[model samples]
Target chain A: MAETGTSAARSDAWGVWGGNPPRNRGRQPGELETDQLTIAGEQLPSRLILGTGGATSHAALEAAIRASGTGLVTVALRRLDPGAPSLLDVVERCGVRVLPNTAGCYTATEAVRLAHLAREAFDTAWVKLEVIGDEETLLPDAVELVTAAERLVEDGFTVLPYTTDDPIIAQRLADAGCAAVMPLGAPIGSGLGIRNPHNIALIRQKVTVPVILDAGIGTASDAALAMELGCDGVLLASAVTRAEHPARMAEAMRLAVDAGRLAHAAGRIPRRLYATASSPTGGLPW
Target chain B: MQLVVNAVTADVDDAATIADVVRDLAGIAEPRGVAVALNGAVVPKASWAETRPADGDTIDVLTAVQGG
Candidate 1:
């Protein structure tokens, strides 16, 4: 595949990895300088993927996108409202790849059709496939999702499916040729955080492809926890866009993703019921 | 001819093609980043000029918007 003009700059921005030469030297084992987030042969600079949704204005959204340092952002397809500000223009100006989504589709067929439309509109075969089962919960219809993912994959799309936390479903999506499986930490926009970290870890273990935690991130810590739980990346919208200060929150989320990834790479200490003294107990007088 | 564009019924010229609908009816002067769906199938940009909607056909003219 031909590299986009931004690829070189993006690789530089990422420091190392993703076909870029190693920049960090003399580093301790398990200490990473930077790990590029690669999905479907595309090496993304930042692990943080922003969704251009719920922002007060395009200016605010652009600021958040720039602050987040995301190399990829998601946009949804909708009926063209004449004279409305173009989200594509703003995203293009920010210099990030667009991952157009089938956000409001309810069935596999609908999602498939929408994905085709996105491919034409965006001029990219990458799609964030979302097939909602219910209106109230906005949870994915697993069966429909898998079906759509299969169809999209067969159609030559680099499919990234939004799925449930079930490890089996994650594996199914990966087996169906999805480039990545985006398991929701909780319901979309609930901001409840990762309700089931164990399941997320299980999904991570189940799939060899990239595992991105999508939805239900209330703050930076939630994104950190997702990374800590073994998610390859984090995809969020309302957590930052809906915050009191979108840019500040975006920056915080960016740092949190990096910190959590480093912590995960560094390997944390094991938990125990009994407390262990950090200082020398033998030398301390009672 | 009449067409159902984005669920809105509108009367258009008989020879109006998908390009005309996208430009004139949808009010999108620059159709670079826009896509059109005739009935239910996507009409590619190159074919949009030749693809005409019959009476009562549903034309969905779509563009990118802020969403997750």
Candidate 2:
């Protein structure tokens, strides 16, 4: 992975992602120590995963994806013209791995079938499992999500389930042998931006697998915040695709993710209700 | 026999398999990156040659599209 110099963003932050080593030995800094994120043993240099949806045009989508520096991009299955240029064409031109999602599925059967179809179509076993319970909020049905995950795992697919922020569902997904648990920060496309950080933190703390903040991200700050809260990655689409300037927003998201990872490793100071002195108390300037 | 493919009506042979229908619609000898579902259930590629769709069946042929 090429170094982005983002590790130097914070002076107090330890050397992270191949910048410099910490001065002290045996003292851990924070969660991330490297630039690579491993999911199902696939090492990726990028922590920001982009989805190929909601872009106004294929040109914008291609440009934004390339600018984001995302290693993994998602595509969905639908009834499309076989003659038209495919989304995979864009993903391939970008030179990134494809993560197929069962986006419109509402049951385990449909999701499982779609997973199988995706595997055959992409010749890949990595699936982003999404079993939405209803059409209103598009919240995942925890039970169906876990069931589809287990089925896919048994079928030799790397299942990455899109679940709720509830830690219990996260644990269920982990227990079902998922590659990772992607908890929504809020409803899809709501741009709510991590409504319950506490729950996300709890899921991160409990699950042994990587925790990815998947949805409800409105801007770069939301992605950075997810990383700061100890998430392994952020998967977003509309936050960048729907922006006024998609390529620029994509760049911002990339920098934000890197900065957030750096801040997490640098070890943030403890929060206090009272003011603390940054300058010496004995300073004569007073 | 008549069949509905992606909401379009088409005429097919009574003994035509799903593979034949796909070939007719997609204009490919052996289609790649496409999946077929008959009556809401996916028809595996291996079985496409033998799985015949009944008259007036809804055949949904789906492929990868840009999505979040």
Candidate 3:
């Protein structure tokens, strides 16, 4: 593992592929390697955070989570349902950390209350704060989100707010002492992919905390694009859960996140309008 | 005493504790992965067996569910 700085925006590129033991994995002589995704001083195994929503069954959800190689998975707190199959059982079996979210809340008080309940229910202080503004878009209410984030942080909770791609809101959340800021690419479950890559990049520049691209992902390419846009990680649910073969899609996303992270580190060639010959002018044969 | 449990009106014994309502009324066989909130404040697991909710008090029993 590479030595990490104490800064909040510490490099997320320290993790090896999938954060798994690289015993027999193929590697070149001098290839760059990384270790784990750290959030709030806790290390996560992978950069992809899977949301346990919209799955057809527990069996399928478990398979998808395993395939994705995600170290953290999001769950929501809801009214107890005795008849409903236990989601905790599957998550515990998978062995990933549960990140409870305030998904349906529209106000700061509601989200704060849910966070408290989640802390007791899950026995963890980590929360994925979400205060929605509009029901149609499921966008974060900027004011309410900041307020809830501040309150949660004050109460010793590690808050990660799901917010807009706007750099200003992202900065505000970070300033509120949140562990991380999750900016959406589009509306929740819309699968539209990153609507504004520029804003995501700007957010990366603005916030010191980790930037996670949450929601509005349709496929593996979208996940890859998020990493390329400088997001530390990606969070999505319907993209994999709603797919015909969730496990397969999960695998694709896992690979894409790895590939994209490496590509981002490797850096891409600058785009040029005019033609640039690969063959040297003097070495070209007549 | 009548207490609102998870939005449903439940008639419970006057001495019913939060744990009682959770186990008997909410039908949670095992309290693992379960949490209770009296009114709007969360009640810790250690206090559930001793804390009794008053009549008309809202008790929200929450647990982990598949969601984002």
The C-alpha TM-scores of every prediction are 0.90, 0.86, 0.90
Measured against the true two-chain complex, the DockQ scores of the candidates, in the order shown, are 0.77, 0.61, 0.80
- What are the lDDT scores of the predictions, listed in order? 0.88, 0.87, 0.87
Q: How are the candidates ranked when ordered by DockQ, highest leading?
A: 3, 1, 2
**lDDT for position A138 in model 2:** 97
Query: Higher DockQ: candidate 1 or 3?
Result: 3
Model 1: fraction of native contacts: 0.86
Candidate 2, superposed: residue stretches over 4 Å from native: A1-34, B46-54
Interface RMSD, in order shown: 1.1, 1.6, 1.1
Which regions of candidate 1 fall more than 4 Å away from where they truly are? A1-33, A284-286, B26-29
Stretches of candidate 3 off by over 4 Å are A1-33, A282-285, B26-30
Q: Which lDDT tens digits does candidate 2 get at residues A162-250?
A: 99999998998899899999999999999999999999999999999999999999999999999999999999999989988787678
The chain A TM-scores for the candidates, taken one by one, are: 0.89, 0.88, 0.89
Summarize candidate 2's per-residue lDDT along B1-68 as a digit string, tens digits.
99999999999899999999888888885666788889878787889999999999999988888888
lDDT, residue A37, candidate 3: 70
Which residue pairs show collisions in model 1?
A: none
lDDT of each residue in A1-286, candidate 3, tens digit only? 1112323332244232224333224645334335467899988888999999999889889888987889899999999888888898999899999999999999999999999889998889999999999899898999999999999999999999999999998888888899999999989999999999999999999998999999999999999999988789999999999988787678789888877787788799998999998877795467
Give the alpha carbon lDDT tens digit for every residue of A1-286 in model 1.
1112334565577542222233244456434434788898878989999998898889888888887889899999999888897787888798999999999999999999999999999899999999999999999999999999999999999999999999999999999999999999999989999999999999999899999999999999999999998889999999988988787678789888987887788799999999998887686566
Which candidate number has the best DockQ?
Answer: 3
* Candidate 3's DockQ: 0.80
Model 3 local distance difference test score = 0.87
lDDT of 1 by residue, B25-45 (tens): 556555757888999899999
